[model samples]
Target: MTAERPAVDPRWWGPPIGGVAFALAYPPVDLLPLALVGLWPFLWFLDKELENAPSGSWRGAFAGGYLFGLAQYGALLYWIAGLTGFSVMAVPAYVASVMVMAFNGALTAGGCALGRRFGIPVAVSFPLAWTGVEWLRSFGDLGFTWAVAGDVLANYPLLIQPAELGGVYLLSLWVVALSTAAWRLVRPRSDTPRTATAAMVVVVAAAVPAYGALRLDRLERQLEGWPTLRAAAIQPNVPQDMKWEEAFETEIHRRLSVLTLRVAPREPELVVWPESAVPSWLRYDPRTRALVPALAAQIEAPIFTGTNDADTLTGRSGREAGDYRVYNAAYLVRPDSIVSNRYAKQRLVPVAERVPFVPGMATGFFERLSAWTGQFSRGEEWTTWTVEGFEFGALICYESVFPSVSRALVLEGADFLLNITNDAWFGRTAAPYQHASHLSLRAVEHRVPFLRSANTGISGWVDPLGRWRERTPLYEPATVVADLPIPGGGTPYTRWGDWLPFACVLAWGGLALVGAARARTAPRGRGSVVASSTGR
Candidate 1:
């Protein structure tokens, strides 16, 4: 009974290795080309383990993929721990999110194995499976669009300008396709010519940037005469620990007032502050509410700053409303000493603001755990503000990461996008830069000038062509004043949102169905048919 134990599969290490490579492909390391080979180890492991094994070996594919995902997402998102550091539950909550994201990775691997076992080409199958899973990952309350493979290309704007056509997943598809093609060319196979596979990879790599270059040229020239708005985006460098302290409210206001005066010589038409720049709720506090208008009049420029606002809900009867809601709101103060527009944030951060569809989250243990953070009500409208003849959409923190929010604003006549965030919560970490990178794609996708004002740093502006300017350093208290261009017309992406990814999804599903149908029609013990003209 103490006989030899079963031997461990050598391929068990493949996923973790692949995860390391994948993590290296994102920020803090950001080896962009490494993404092309990041999945090679995992894919190679799948091919060797499942190619000739009994049909039941597909289970191993899921296990291996989960391991890879755990390593990949775990390493990629480790910075979340720093952002959630104050809570004792931070580590466990971060670990739980990593575990949930790993399931998507496992699903991708399993689908790839099943497709290949049914005789589909590995090059086609890998991208199809990956893109499908990634598209699904972007949905629902748990959806997190951070650190997708495509985000690696955010630094190379010309290469990713085509996000205007297909959104982020489209770029993910292109990256996975390139990786799969490279894997096919490098590995020995009974199917497909290596030369043909290499040629296809080269074509894809060359064609994407070529298309991007042409598009950038056209858009830049078209935007040459567009109206420009001079803005002073302020970074107060407030510490997260002291941000909401009652003792710091007056001091914080004085700090911002001084910074606004520092940028006064630039004579900006609009002065902007980061999210929740003031500690107190502006609408509820008469002094703070009056402060904005007075400051606007003193500067002789319209000002935009974040605050909390509360509105009482009255029933159909003219009686006092029993219900009240508080919003994470943005206010526009006119130079004429008037508060002109107020826009509430629509997409609040889950659990941090209001839990998703879980009423118990309101008064249960979760509420007690997050009591330090306010439970904010969601805004119902997609609102845009106007200042200095430019119409702009004000996206609160975390909202810029969602493509649909910015797109809807542009479609509704927003000429530019202003993102206000208090990234002090992330502290002196890669989280600020990582968060800023997501906004670049939004700028490209909507063909608008995107301006960002962060509480600490990485504040900047990106033009319609994906060309960026006025970036501030991390943890620095600085005001970036820039003349940002306003978009004159909508891009194709604004006209037809996410249609390209939807089409890719349809094609991928069809191929999977075809492969499944073919597998069922063939003999049970015949095994997978090797197609010589295609790589497995």
Candidate 2:
């Protein structure tokens, strides 16, 4: 009998085109439905390699996966180009980051290929492996979890309520599972019928939204007559280039003073300012330090704003009194107190604000290129400010993306959360919108209301149910005053954080081990049709 020829695979066109669908699912474009099926084409492409590639299948899988990744991130993070005014090197840095992050795709492809080499079906293996890689990508010092596949639904409060149960990982799991089922339905294999898969996917897809609707209803009822706090969020709309200039310091302070006075009629118990609201150090600069308390005294409310800070080491560790470590910090100024309470920023922006494990000289070079000093020191503890008996935690810019940070503050007696960000660096790009969306999820995840004050826009309040009470337009000098509700207790997500992702890690590890063992033991040319078939 003549040996059979392997099928021809056309891998070039499918994955890269499909990748754009994921890009559109995020902000600026935001066609969310595309997220559900965007990866289907890549999955199909991987299947082709498994069934037909003579050898070096993993090479083809990696290449295709990387291509898909390049396309996906290239489109999603094109806003990185907006940083060009700061540094020409920013373009290459963005590319390097995207290339590193694209391992997510490579891992997914490799995992799926291993699954096929064993006896695991596409429906079971694809979702499991994909979610595992996503969860993995969310960790480590360089973890970049922006625009996870499920974050597309962030605009829909009801659909994303389950995020409180499992964080974004659960939603990602749901998306992958549904996608796999839908693909199986569209292209039925001999063992699994199209109708069965379609019915299962439909039931799941319908049930999630139905559950979300119910949860939203329950939340509305539960939140009735909850405690409320009246607060003002200030968006200064200061230009990034001029913010750090000494020439504009007087003008900047004047604008802030005018805005604070503008909201006096609202009689906000607390006035929140955007990240890096003051270019100078509030604690160290004698003039600026005096001005803060003076403003708080004038406004008759505790003024909370982002500013640079430093802790003098003095004699500690044999350092001189003048030796100090600077921080990206939030300062609380009361009428009688000057810089009495402060929270140093814990999560600094990766490249712009921090460069991990680099020499001081090299770090300074990059910082100067981006118009910043060297990386800042990390905060040791979570800080909450109590204003007129209303307690809230401050999450500085870029810190809100980490779900753990917000939950920790909630668990530490924070009734609400305040996120201060200066997104002026991103210009009119999608970064600001995407950055603001994270706070909504954080609100739901911790069952606490969130107030965001962005320097150039997206300043608003998200209620306990993840609903936006008020959202300001981009680049507008605006003040949003609202009576934000405070939830009494934490949600399920608060009690259990990232449990689902941990379980997924375990499950994926077991599957990978089994697949490896099976691949080693199975005969060379005796592959089952179920293992090789793409169903379509």
Candidate 3:
């Protein structure tokens, strides 16, 4: 009898196209539904691959996964071009950044492929593998947790309360699980598939109502009445190119002073400026220091602004070394004595602020990329500054995305969170909106009010329930003044960080291993049969 030809495979096109579609769905735009459809092909591919392969082929999986990642990241982060002055320069950097992000995609694909080879169902393995990969991607040298799957629902606060339980990772897991489960049931092979899919649907459906009930209950509970304080977020609208120039320093100060005086009638208890509002070192500028105390006294509150600081000392080599530490630092200037609360930004943007691992062989490339560098020293500890009984944690620019960084501040006794950012680098792109959305999640996570003051607009206060009290227009010169209620108690997320996601990853890993072992010892004939039937 003639050997039967292997069944025609249909999964090869799914992942890459799905990844690309998902990328297109990301904000400051929304095409997520289409992206979901795109992902079906990739999911189908993995299902087929797993059924056919007795021993997982790492090489095939890696190649496919990497391509998918490349497409996904490339599409999503293409907006990074908004940061650079010229499109020529921006395009290359954008490409590089996307390439960096693709690393996560490759890992996710490979992990899923391996899991499937062990007979784990697509509904279980895809979500688990995705969760593990996302968690891993949040750390490491090129770590950037932006554009997370959970962030897709950022525009809708009501659906995002699950973040309080397992943080953003939980939401991501749910999205993946629901999508995969739906796919599995759409073309069911087993009699019980309907029941399994229905269960998944119920779980996902229940989360929405559960979250709504929790929000209603929380809102009904009376918040501890704190003194209503007015705050001014100064927007100087300094151009990115001129922001660092010596001539623009005086103009920036003038503009800020003008805006500060305009809001003085409202009598804001605190007047805040964006990160590095002052281009020069405060200590070196006697004129500026003379002006700060007067400004603080005039406002009858405190003036918190960003400035650079420097220190000089002799090194072990005996030659006097000038330690010019460029800080995305904040200063709290009071009338009596300037209680300087400086928070040097810990998480610097990779190439723009500080290059990672520059001490070794990468120094040459680092030096070349150091054209627009800010060699700022990272802060070692979280510090909460108190002004008139109100304690606030300060995050400068890019530090807002780091959940641990903000959570640490809350743990250290902060009543509210303050973020100072100069988003002129991103021009009029989705970066500012995307950056602003992170504050809402952080507020929900910590059950604390978040006050953001950005240079080029989108400055706002997010309440404990992820509600925006006030926000300014993007790329506009404006001020957002609002009264934000501070939550008295911390949420479960603030108390315990990443525990749920970590548990999920560990459980998935265990399952993957068990499946792998079973596949390893299966009869050769059975393995061949599975391989032939499932061949893609």
Candidate 4:
């Protein structure tokens, strides 16, 4: 007799479908409301897996979540393949980034599965589990904080006004809570009535938007009272590969100079350039230094541009001691031919910018990989630069995406923000738009104007209320004369820092402990209790 084939679980299909739902909620698809329904599919799948195979299903649950993450991150980060333009390493880089990010998804699902085993309800377990995992992903050398569920609200400035009070984590919690309500509506797994679910959907749809309208109106009125400064950002549209070639450096300089001169009639108080606008070290390269100051003088405005900087490290011995570390730095050149301040990039992209920590003796291969990119030392502190009586933080490329980095800058008394980046690596993909999404939240959280100057495209200004100005198109050479509305004070997010994530972590931990205690006393058929507790 032929061996019988095992039955395929329909729930197994949940992960990828769920992942795609989440990915579809992001840009290029531009389905803003889909994010609310994104997690429902995965949650249904997890709950089902936990019920049918209640015993020793934690691994299965984790695998399902990981698959879901693979689907989500795979779609969300496919643009990474364009980072190297269809090369041998492109697939691996794309795969590795997705795989690494999937860990957070795995943890979220696995921990929730464990919570189910402990008898914690799905309603309570999933949000706590998911938010906690995001918290964990936000730290350490490999930390990546992009395209979280909360960021769905970034496009709607009014909807994200709550960011000033609780930061994006608060909105993240809000997303999960509403998602749970929606899930219960379709699945009816929980005892929560259709009316209650309908009510929640109503609140988020109608009441929340109403609140956002009121807040936007108030914030706009408030901004009208704030002082404003005209700022110009230069987009050179420099090709990624040719930028590194020795022969092309002079042409690149000429291109930038011409653009700066074009915006000179606008008479901006300050002029900004994209990250590494010049290939050479403006601080040490005598020729480039002379050229930049002259341009600043000609424009009659301080020029803030990204360039390489280096300083020799002297040990306790005072002589040429340890080492001189190269930095990805920013400089503000004055009309008086002076370089006032330098800000080094703190957060570096793993592998692309700097390889992650490995044993000192075993870093040969990684360093070789990073050699073409030329890794730089990490910056130690956040610095704000002042020109024409207006103060702003210089966020170098990856740093602006980080909420903490921007908050720290605002806390340091910055009235406005500047994000300079070379996004040529992203090419003609949704990556530029995805990268810009985080800045909107950052602007709202601190109630300060945020300006982004990218080497390739997706460059624009974000108002304090998180509204975006008309963005420059990709691979286009343009000068954006932006009016920056300067805020006089900081928001609660800037003053208090991220407190919501900590609360979520603590709540998740406590709920897990409660589940453990309940499980110890429950019967052998422990799955029934969890199945019944889905609404808890």
TM-scores for all predictions:
0.92, 0.91, 0.89, 0.93
Q: Pull out the clashing pairs in model 3.
A: 14-41, 14-42, 15-42, 18-38
Task: Rank the models by TM-score, top first.
Answer: 4, 1, 2, 3
Instruction: Please state the error at residue 231 of candidate 3 in Å.
Output: 2.4
Segments of candidate 2 deviating more than 4 angstroms: 1-9, 53-56, 188-191, 314-323, 359-374, 514-536
Q: What are the lDDT figures for the candidates, one per model?
A: 0.79, 0.79, 0.71, 0.81
TM-score of 4: 0.93
**Compared with the true structure, what per-residue lDDT tens digits does model 1 show for residues 52-144?**
654425688889889989999888778667655566556766788789889767987787666665566666767877777776776766666
Tens-place lDDT per residue, model 4, 345-461, is: 988886666667742212467667666444677888789887668778888887876788998888887899999999888777888888888888998889888878899977889
Off by over 4 Å in 3: 1-12, 31-38, 86-89, 187-192, 220-228, 316-320, 337-339, 359-365, 372-374, 517-524, 527-536
Local error of candidate 1 at residue 423 (angstroms)? 0.9
Model 2 lDDT per residue over 245-346, tens place: 999999999888889899988889999999889878887788888887888888789888998887766665676766556788997888897566679987
Model 3 Cα lDDT, one tens digit per residue, 309-333: 6556467998776544455577888
**Candidate 1 lDDT:** 0.79
Backbone clashes in model 1, listed as residue pairs: none
lDDT computed for candidate 2? 0.79
| Per-candidate RMSD, Å | 2.9, 3.7, 3.9, 2.7
lDDT leaderboard ranking: 4, 1, 2, 3
Off by over 4 Å in 1: 1-7, 54-56, 313-323, 359-361, 364-366, 369-374, 523-535
Clashes of each: 0, 1, 4, 0
Backbone clashes in candidate 4 total: 0
